[model samples]
Structures are given as C-alpha cells and as structure tokens.
Target: MATDLRVSLTDRCNLRCTYCMPEAGLQWLAKPDLLTDDEVVRLVRIAVTQLGVTEVRFTGGEPLLRPGLPGVLERCAALRPRPRISLTTNGIGLHRTAKTLRTAGLDRVNVSLDTLRPEVFRTLTRRDRHRDVLEGLAAAHAAGLTPVKVNTVLMPGLNADEAPELLAWALDLGYQLRFIEQMPLDAQHGWRREELVTAEDILRRLGERFTLTPEGSARRGSAPAERWLVDGGPGTVGVIASVTRPFCRACDRTRLTADGQVRNCLFAREETDLRTALRSGEPDEALADLWRAAMWGKKASPDLDAPAFVQPDRPMSAIGG
Candidate 1:
C-alpha cells in the first residue's frame, strides 16, 4: 500500500512559468468545487487513522498560495499517529509565512528555484520575484526547515546551461539540488520530447565542473531523484529523470487533487471522486474503501517512449506533483 500521500491544496498559482502555463494563466478552479478546510482535514485524518499513510506532502499550483494552509498543517499535525508533513512551493510568499508554517507543524519544504540569474528567472517564470525566492529560501532555513531541497527544471534554450552553476550554489548553501527533466505536463501541451534536457545530458554537463559518484540504488529506493555524492563528499545532487528513466515500479505515492479526486498515478487519466461521497455523508470506512479501490486499480507505469503513450489531460499543477 502507498503510505505516502501527495495532497494538492489548490490548483491556483501565482507564477506563470513558461514550462507550466501560459502568460494568460490557466482557468482557476471554482471555490465551490474545492474541498473546504474542514473537509481537507477530515480526509487527512482518515488517511492517517483508517488508512496506513505515514507521510503527507501538501502540493499545489503553489501550496503557499492557499490561505488556509497553516491551519490545515496544524490539523494534520494533531493526528494520532502523526504523519510527517511537507510542502512543495514556488517560494513566492514563503518569507512571510515560513515561521508561521513551522509553528503550525510543517516539517520541511521543497522549493522551486530554476535559475539564480534574475533576468533568466523572470524570462522563465514571467515574474520579477527572484529576490523574493532567495529571501523565502533564507526564511525557510532560518525557520529550521532543514535539508532545504531545491527543484530545478532545465529547459533546452532557457536555463539548461546553468546546471553546474545551480549545483555549485546549492552546495555552498547546503541545499539539496535536484535537476528534473521537463515532462509532457505543461498546460500548453506543446512539450516535445526532443526539446527536453535529458538526465544523461545533465550529468555530462555537470561532470565538467564536478566529480559526482552515484549513491547507488539501495540508498535511492523509491525516491524519484537518483542521487550522487558531489565532489565525493556529503553535499550531493539529484536527477529526476522521469521521462527517460521511470521509477514507477517502486512508486509508493497516492495523489489527491484539491477537488477531492484520487489519482493513482501522476499520469493517470482516471480520477476517483471522494468529495461527492464525503458531501453525501458517506462513512469514513466507505471513503477509505473508495481510496483503496482507486489504488488497487492503478494503471501500469507509463512508458513514455511508446508510440501509444499520450500525455495526461491535466497539467502537473492540476495533478498535485
């Protein structure tokens, strides 16, 4: 059973990253369709108490954008056999809420910082908030969110050349750096396989400036990122090569969208609705059984290289990853 659950707080985002969505932005989810704070906390309580979920990661178009985020974290923290809670955010307003979130029981964070150069950052995210991200990162660290992980996606013509520089910056600051291959999850559906910066390409480029020794599969386990010891020391870097190298067989994650739908896989087309049952006054056991059936029917790991493969209808933002 999947003990790690990724729950999307909202599909709304503050940034317009070129790789994520267009400058015009996506059609935001209606508030009425979204799970209320009480509903969210109740589902989480069931997942921890009735189900065997051990880790809970709050995601979003950007999780920090959710106004009731801190309260949700507080409730999850109060679970009997408390689940380890984390958030994945764009680091936009983190500087303002990092301390409050920490106090509300957030364990740590995985922030997106694709580039260090302000000009490049603006060009990529279509936002002039690079300094804000830096400040947010500092605030997160100051608030005791240790092992601050930085997620970077290298686009072909955009920030791909900055891989080594990005890793060096992370090493200097003791941040765990991860380079992700751009996937077919963009809202525009214009993602071309040939345009992606492959994992092998990232390794080759980084190899020019650093010596990276593979930490091996035994240590990697089910985590998407394949880690490497940077310069043969404690500081390390990781590559989430989801396209060329899929680790779905070892995947132990379950996803819940903001609207209370369960997605067995990140690329799955099918969604099982939990909100309706909850709204209809279904018992907690019924909801748990519905969740179990969804997982039990999870499709096989997607073979991106296959000709039959089709990109998921929903973008990454909507899917909670």
Candidate 2:
C-alpha cells in the first residue's frame, strides 16, 4: 500500500512507434547519462529498504533493449519486502527471452498490442512485428507469468474499430486486456485532442455484443484501469479512462527515469535527479534524501483533470508509462 517503484532499464527501443517517438529519428541518451545495471539494482534495493516500497516494475522505451535484464531482475527479486516485480515491453525482444526472464524472477508482463490486423499493427506501431508480439504473449503465458496483460492504447480513428475484436481475442487467449484512453503524453505530439474517445463509448459498444459485470478489484495504488469481467471470457478486461474519469485522487506510484531522476507526476514540469547522489559514494544518507524528496513530492496526481488538459514536456517513452 506504500509507494511503488518504477525503474526504467533503458531509453532505447526497437520500434519507432509514432505515438512515442518521431519517425525522423531518435537521439539516444548518452550511456553515461543512464543508470548502469548495478546502479539500477542498487537503487531498487535502497527503495525497498528505505522507502517502504512493496512493488517494483521495470519499464522503458523498451526495457528488454537493456543488456543483462535478467540479471537486474534477479537482484530486484531479492528485496526483503519481496516486491511484485513486473515488466512492460512492446515484446519485440521477448520472443525467445521471455522464459529466461521468468526464470530470472519476473512476476508478470504487460505487452502493448494495439491492433490485431497485420497492416494496421505495422501502421500504428511503425513496425511489422505483430507476429512477434503474439509469440511473446504465448511465451509469457508458458512461463507462468500470472494474468498476462495486453495494454491497448485506444485511438479513435485508428484502432477503435478493432476494440471488440481485440477484446474477444484476449478473452479467447485468457489474457487480461486493458484499453487505455489516449492522453497527451507523446514527446512528438501530433495527437489530435478532438480524437478523444471516452471509456463509456468503448464499453457501451462492447456491452451491446456481450455482457459485462463490474468485478471488485484493488482500488488502491495507482488504479489505472477500472476493473470489470466479461460474462463468458476466460479472463477479465480493464478500461483506463484517465481522460474521462481521472483516478488521480488515488495515485500512489512515483516514476524513476533511467537517468535516476524521480518524477513525482509524469505530467509535472519538474523532476529531481538522483543519479548524482547515488554516485556520490554517500550511499546511505544520500539515498534517504532522494527517497524523502520523492515521497513528499508524491501527489494524488497532476491537475490535468479535463479533456482540455495539455501535457507538459515529458515524452511517454521517457516517462515509462
């Protein structure tokens, strides 16, 4: 129930998803600017021991792009609190390494899959790796990662029609599918705010075809999705309507960028750098100060409580979702 830790493993990604990065090109952050594997693990240990963190999730432009990911997972799994260690990936690198990661101590995985159509998939993600993502999902399932989740960013004009098909597909495969309402988080924003599609519209369309029942779930700790179970599916589906129904009041997680900066809110204009203190060799007290500052900066959330809200200058890729 305390603060959760989100450690970004890398700033690089294989796919040039239009929503995340511009097609022109991406300038890689200097390696020295990012946390090394050992440093990241060390910080996670400090977070668990000193910051009352009970859960940890690995995120990134693509966390799997980071070398020694399995090794990092092992260290994080050793936390005394036994935090639920998870990872979010686009699944490009997960086809075969999925099980290896599980053996290394990953609890679960959330894969981003927006379109089921091959053409549309490539168009949206700007990569023709839809097949790889599907394989990754199966590999993840075989690895015993409980409740494998599929995160779909519902774009009105693009992937919206695929919503029902996507949901039904997830149901058949026993994967928990979540449809997230688009927010203005992309760094290279061509996001059409007028394209906003509310969660009600999505559910209303789906409910007409199948029954849905509100299933009680953990309303605590950064509840991005409103929980609900379909009447006859193998698993449930969630809808994260941040634009329509802000759950900011219950926000409980703070983001730690790969560069060792603490982002109190992804929408916040400011971020506190922890890399300097972490490397200062004053490990104990310095870490305490970083955690203390991050904890105090934790808000229920940013005040972007309306559809008219414009996001500040942080890319969703950099923010680690």
The most accurate candidate by TM-score is 1
Runs in model 2 with CA error above 4 Å?
217-222, 232-234, 305-310
For all the candidates, what are their Cα RMSDs to the real structure? 0.8, 1.9
For residues 1-321, could you state the per-residue lDDT of candidate 1 as single tens digits? 789999999988888998889889479889999999999999998889988999999999988988899999999999989999999999999999999999999999999999999999999998899999999998999999877899999988888999999999999888899999888888999888889899999999999999999999999988999999988989999999999999999999999999999999999999999999999999999999999999999988998867788998999989899
> How much lDDT does candidate 1 score?
0.93
TM-scores, all candidates, are: 0.99, 0.94
> Candidate 1: which stretches are off by over 4 Å?
none
Question: How much is 243 displaced in model 2, in angstroms?
Answer: 1.4
Please report, in order, the local distance difference test score of every candidate based on alpha carbons: 0.93, 0.81
lDDT (tens digit, per residue) of candidate 2 on 147-227:
799998877678887778888899888898998887778767766657777798889877877788876655334667887
Clashing residue pairs, candidate 2?
none
